[model samples]
Target: MDVDLPYRLELISDLPGHDERAWQVAWNPTKPLLASCSADKSVRMYSYRPSDHGSKSLAFSHMGTIPTGHTKTVRSIAWAPSGKTLATGSFDSNVGIWEREDVSDSEDAGETAGDWECMTLLEGHETECKSVGYSSSGTLLASCSRDKTVWIWEVKPDADFECMGVLMEHSQDVKCVAWHPSEEILASASYDDTIKLYIDDPSEDWFCFSTLSGHKSTVWSLSWSPQGSYLASSSDDLTIRIWKRVEEHEWKSVLELRGHERSIYSISWGVGKGASENLGWLTTTGGDGKINVWEITEMQHTKDPLSATLIARISGAHDVNDVNSVSWCPRLEHPDLLATAGDDGSVKVWRVVPS
Candidate 1:
């Protein structure tokens, strides 16, 4: 495979001005909108359309900006499974869901020209919500906070906006939580230097089915493979580890990926990860000003790979700015695009220029 990348710098879009660094950006799966929330105490949406068939993503236009009711910084943002709603968690220890209500042509058409409003505000976590995400089915919203716990909330069958359950498991602040694409299990990484697994089983209490240990520092982020059988985690220890389950009784770490020179801050699994025919890749960004993609190959988990193949190295994307988070677009209709946020005050979009 041969391709030439100029390593060029291009500005895709200028988002709304933030009073401080933005923490996260999420792409809507069912529309052409991108949502970002930041220290400015606001969440805004920008509309983007390809100027031409093969044009690089530039020329994004601001559509609408919503001033959230929270007085603190927004920590994380997640688009609902249907893309009709968005979830945001804040440093104020509150999570809010925003839903789009289509304005009919006959019902005061000129009054408002937007498709979204805050539908609900959820309160349970006692400290700042560190992470929030929608499950694969979107019926559940999982949130973790500085209070050292994660809660799983189920939407009510009758009430359009209602919270149902709370999961109390981890003994340390849960840094991140990820839902498996096809299973009911959820994986979370914590500052306690351990990973916990939770499955929604009715007969038993919401407890850690297993605790994975190996990281030498705080765990920052976790992502599940597309098959929902494996988990990838990155840490301030400067390592990324892959974990895969064997049968239903046990799980094993298959490989440890290493390359970044600074503390690893964020990571994402490739959309096609965990397939028999494809080499599963994990992309990580850190304070070192480098983005490394690790190619994983497993003969079997029983015999872990001694190392991972470094498939791609990108620098200057965030550089000294310290990228706060990175997310691979959900494995849906488009799999080539990825979004990242940082102290640089921008969300950059990248596409894999196939080799």
Candidate 2:
């Protein structure tokens, strides 16, 4: 089988905002907006739209900052599928929900702007909250923490949220929680070196359907494929593992990508216009301060177990700092675009151009 080789991911620009480590970055699902959280105890949003004047280079302008009510570091952020709401998890052991409000002024000639307001605070975790995520339908929210538990919240009408259930399966700290791309299933990674999958059935309720246990160390982050069939996890074991669903409630590791010189902190899968039968492309960042693009061919990965290959790697991606997170632009117009954050307190954007 022929493959696309030697993909080039060129750095477009560095977006500086935070005074400390930027822990996570997320792209809005339906808008040209990007959100990031940092250890500085603040949240920042940017307005990003590629120029149509024939230049492929990208630029992001600082839109505004939200002085989040949290007293500690904001570790993770996720935007609702409708791009109308944002959720942030913090070390203060609270989750803040932000809603976008339209701003208008007569002196500005009736032009409109966006103002994000802290709508409500969800508090229940015993310790630091590490990650927060919203389901594809935006009706459910998930958060995991150092408390070794994952909490699912039901988004009710009139700015009300209730804890639907709590998952306490991981013996160690839960690092991240990600919802499936299409389904209501949820996956959480933990320091117990395992990934647990959960589903909500009307009769069975929310229960762990399967446990993916193969990583030798802490699983730091997870990213599900666009079709919700495959999941990629990065770990302190210094590798990125790809798990493909075999049975309806079972999954197995099909490939282990071992190239990062240090702990792999985050991984993100690209999104495009078509339903890719393969894994398409994935980007991973780690303590080594490098970003690697892996081209995956899962057509026979269920039986082959060696279907992914590294196509491009950018060294010193965050300049000697631990790169914390990596995410691909979700917009259909710029699927090849990527975003990365690091301990150096900067967010860099790149274009993964295929050769």
Candidate 3:
């Protein structure tokens, strides 16, 4: 736990265009692409190419943009694991499913290429949908909203989706929902200051398997370790809590990371070089307009006063605006890269290379 940072974080480039705050930025799981949503009611996509060896930044070119279709702010965007579809949640209280039409097969390949079509809209959420995520298997999508509910949808062929379950378990606004990296288990964070884990039963019904409660204020986001053994949650309580599965249907708080002076908005776990078992690094963004890199060790979790060490920090990471979200590029080609969105309406790309 006491070592120099193995990686050096360098701000590479910024993508700016949104007229309002950018709420979320997500990296495509299978492609060199990034998608971002904003309060300006649009979703933008950028394709990344590695820069020259000695260049200080990565290269990301604007591919295209989905029209301003959402009547209100677009809060979240998620790409299916297959890289063929996208789901976006908005303040308009609706969810949009977008698919790329196969335009390359046309006789005139130049005219119809790169066509993205809105396949369908899911309109069941009664309030602003805060987040949307597809399960790792790509067969299910989960969405949570201010209406205090989480909805699971079954993905059918040809963009057909069926609402499988409506989980009305949270007592306050449901802020974010995330699927486990390797399982169908779903986790939702809420304004009630709790995170609930759910799984589908043999009857095809989703049920709460466990509730993680420690944050003293609203739980804003949840992220699972790449190995699927631990869960991390950020909260308005200004702390990030790590939970370990101790037994079947049970989880225990293993570490409480306190550093940010204000509400912690987002957290993401990434693969690190020489990552020990249940030990690695993570990045956190918050209302304080700072980004922090933390090192978590499983050995520390076994000791009293378990905690993670802050390895590095960037003050004013977003030019005095809250960093709303941070995501590590999951593809193998760019494992050391991170993308962040901020209230300043920009998406930044940062490279974390071994120092």
Q: Give RMSD to native, each candidate.
A: 4.2, 3.6, 3.4
Residue 185 miss distance in model 2 (angstroms) = 0.7
- Compose the digit string of candidate 3's lDDT tens values, residues 1-355: 1236555667887899788999999987766678899999988888766567655456777777887498999999999997778899999999999877764433333233476788999999999999999999999999999999999999999889999999999999999999999888999999999999999998768999888888999999899888888899999999999998888678888788888899999999887544555356688998998888877666644564344666666778789899999998887656668899999999998876656
Give the per-residue lDDT digits (tens) of candidate 1, residues 107-158: 2222345656788888888989988988888887789998988888886553
Taken over the whole model, the C-alpha lDDT of each candidate is 0.72, 0.86, 0.85
How many steric clashes between backbone atoms does each model show?
Answer: 0, 0, 0
Q: What TM-score should be assigned to candidate 2?
A: 0.93
How far out, in Å, is residue 327 in model 1?
A: 1.3
Over 1-355, each residue of candidate 2 has an lDDT whose tens digit, in order, gives 0134567668876889899999999988776678889999888887765556657665677778888979999999999887778899999999999986774323221124667789999999999999999998999999999999999999998679988899999999999999999899999999999999999878766889899999999999999988888999999999899898888888989788888889999999885322366567888999999888887775543667547767778888888899999999988778788899999889888887665
TM-score of each: 0.86, 0.93, 0.92
Candidate 2 worst ten-residue window by lDDT: 103-112
Evaluated against the true structure, the overall lDDT of model 2 is 0.86
As for candidate 3, its clashing pairs are none
Total backbone collisions, model 1: 0
